[model samples]
Target chain A: MQFIVEDVVTHLAVKVTEPRIDAAIATPFKDKLREIVVKSRKPIHLDMASVDFMDSSGLGAMIAVRKSLPQNLGMVLCALTPNVERVFRLTRMDSVFDIRPLTAQKEHRE
Target chain B: MTPIERSEPKRSTRASAQVQPMFHRVLSAQPETVRDTLQDVRRRFQGEVSDDTLGRLELVLAEVMNNVAEHAPAGAGAPDDSVRLPVIHLCIVRHTNGLACALTDDGVSLPDECILPRSLPALVMDDLPEGGFGWFLIQDLTQALCYYRESQRNYLAFSIPFAQSGAA
Candidate 1:
């Protein structure tokens, strides 16, 4: 249950390094996300590029985390692998959450 | 104007055994073991089926096995501290049409409903659904998904077509 957090201009991007997020780490993952969500009022971006698989519990955990946040703050998912994306699509969660492609931002030309 | 004689599309005529030998393995009903078992199952069928089929199989297996580990008790009315770990038996076979999987667990049986939901519930912000999506995903991706309780054991079987076609 390791995540590498990156600071973006308007949000914090957390990259889940685990290949799979199933029942084993669902609860702990939710707790960790809660801690981060509460600490920062800015929007959060979950980078799931490395997560090739996510079962029901993992999907549930994500939903729980999103619900725990204050209404003002926001959470978005990005860079989901094809397999993981299917779960979201099949469950109709792609419409519920703000999902972005891997190329969410372009390099700053400063 | 000329009419072209069209040849019929060839259908798969390979025997089940020639495609892939039936895979069977028993594992302790634990989250870690279930995850490992799914990985092994995926590896075994990687080259045999399309990636989409493999992904569906992996998702279904994970949901079922994890449900067992999380909710199924070792014995009926057994004390939590004294309860023993249960075992799950998994079998997979490749048919011409698709892949079939059967899983058996000696843990507690499903609720009286004994059936999966027909569709996923709406994900509303006021009342979020943390769980209950497992069975929906399984039912959406599989064919002939059935469950039976007999002799104090839970048996589940389902099939995933090699092609991308599905009810959901």
Candidate 2:
């Protein structure tokens, strides 16, 4: 349930530190991410590199956060593990959000 | 007896045999416990099953178990001191083709629509759906999905097939 937000100028780069986002943390996870994105009011670049697993509830949370933002604002999901990515791909939510491959930043960071 | 008939008896007795990698648990229908069981199930069959199959297996189990937890009987759960968490009995056994799973729970009866063939929820971008994907995902990834209610408990069974190797 921890997020590391960095203001990368054009977009707010937010990294999810949690390994799994399931029913256990979906509500709080949504609430926290919603607050962060709403306050910043910038397009988001979400780093899902640490997350190894996510269920439908977790996907719902991500969708809720995306819906919370202004229509013009964007959220790009990156570095999704295979398990986490399947939920999005199977549900066809991958079409709704901007998904990117793992960036060089992840390799640089500890 | 044919070879198939010879092995059928042995495989049916998998519960008592150590040859098959199996998992069985009696846990309350709660988010935390369900999560724990999934992790352990993954560990129990880590190298035995491919990662692709394991991922599918985990996601499907999460949806079914959490659905039970979410629909806990009215006045039966949460902050109240007299809380009675629905108890779920889960079992998984690996076969040549796929992993077979069966779950029985004392939670509220499952709706008829769940086991029926279902499509994904309609996509609305402006007001994107936040839910309703659970059952669809469950049905989409499982085979021979079946459900029946007997007296006070609901029984569910399904299988996740092994991954098709080296398919590009």
Candidate 3:
């Protein structure tokens, strides 16, 4: 489990370097992410672009990390790959997490 | 979306017209092994199946095999408290309309409640459920999910339908 944590303008920006978050490493992923997010009292932006696969255990880990944070604080998952996004969407966890696309700019038609 | 088809015992698909890609592996019911097997499975059907169908197939297989790993009983005859992992026999074959999958293992018998109709865990914002999504995803993505215990081995079968032309 590797996360590149940086102090962005208002919150911690984390880049998840792992490609897969299945049962093999879900526990460690949760522990390490929780430690990083709770150390500072700010919002979080998790860049999940690199993760190509995630299962139910991985979903549980994400939920665990979200629950670990203070209720007032927020964690945003950004750039979720299709496979990873499917788990969240199937389980209805999409509503609970503040998911976002990578860029802030609007999509202008060609 | 495909309707759930009731599983037929000892049947995967009607006789196939063309030879399709197939994968078979016998591995321990451990997380690391499960990951490796799933990766290999993806490789076996990379060009043969669409991405949508492949993704669904992978997710369903992961949930089933990992359940075997997670619920493994303690080492049956070990002197020490070493955990004993079940051995999973997995087979997947491509059919004309879907991918047929079958898995057999001698592990803790699946409780009656697992295969019963299930819904997502109650979505309580303050105390969200951490688990219980595995079986739900399996049931949702696969068609004809059937499970039966014969003697000590548990037999399970299902099929993942090919993605519709433009149903998204």
Candidate 4:
């Protein structure tokens, strides 16, 4: 799995190229995201279109990313594929983050 | 009058000697490869199980493999580095009436003090703030689940009962 990091104004958009975002791959991704959050001054958008599955560890990673950012300075957005979306819903994490549909417009226009 | 004596039937003590097909492999601990392996396992064992059973098995395997990949031993470089050598060992055993799987990794074992909470649904739904729900799910779904740490390896095993079609 590959993680592409892009900076957008005050917010950061991370594109995860992995097919699954469960426990096996969540740690490295979480660490990368945390590194990004520590350096960025804006919200973080996790684009997970390529992620077909996400278990609890993946969810925990997201939560950890959310916590790593400065309070009131960082927000977390998730764009999840259908299967991954199902997991988020199953875990009721759908209400925790700004979860965008996989088909939603990208954060950057260009 | 003639008396007739009868002997009590002897019960077999051994587990049914049914031929259980076994499939096992140690694959790259890459998150991207898990789905393909799962699909192959399902396809090969299709008619013998139900969709729900397959889904449960897949979920368990995914969680375990994901744990191995993310936490397995390797210098922190990239996700690919996690699968350097002997990082993951997975086995799927199917019997005439049950299915079992074990996934092992050479990563740091789960902490001894870190108790996997029972309130996973509450944690996920209510944002209760704690983690380790994957362990919970693995324990919840399978009939038998255990975690063993041997030296540097963490082994997670799970099994479920296989429903038989009819009586012989």
Q: What C-alpha lDDT values do all the predictions have?
A: 0.82, 0.90, 0.90, 0.67
User: Over 4 Å off in model 3, which ranges?
Assistant: A106-110, B1-17, B75-83, B164-167
User: Which window of 10 residues has the lowest lDDT sum in candidate 3 chain A?
Assistant: A101-110
Q: How accurate is candidate 1 locally (lDDT)?
A: 0.82
- How far off is each candidate at the interface, as Cα RMSD in Å? 0.9, 0.5, 0.4, 3.8
Where does model 2 exceed 4 Å of error? Answer: A104-110, B1-18, B79-81, B164-168
lDDT by residue (A1-110, candidate 4, tens digit) is: 46798887757788878776665567897887787777777777777767756677777887887777776664555665555654555556667767765435645222
Positional deviation of A103 in candidate 3, in angstroms? 2.0
Cα deviation of B41 in candidate 4 (Å)? 3.6
Candidate 3, residue B151: Cα displacement in angstroms equals: 1.8
Residue B127, candidate 4: how far off, in angstroms? 9.6
Encode model 3's per-residue lDDT on A44-87: one tens digit a residue: 99999899999999999999999999769998999888899889
Off by over 4 Å in 1: A105-110, B1-19, B74-81, B112-117, B166-168
lDDT by residue for model 3 over B18-52, one digit each (tens)? 56789999998989989999999999999999898
- Residues A6-70, candidate 2, lDDT per residue (tens digit)? 99878899999999999999999999999999977689999998999999999999999998887
User: What tens-digit string does per-residue lDDT give for candidate 2 at B133-166?
Assistant: 9999998888889999999999999999896344
DockQ of candidates 1 onward, in order?
0.71, 0.88, 0.87, 0.19
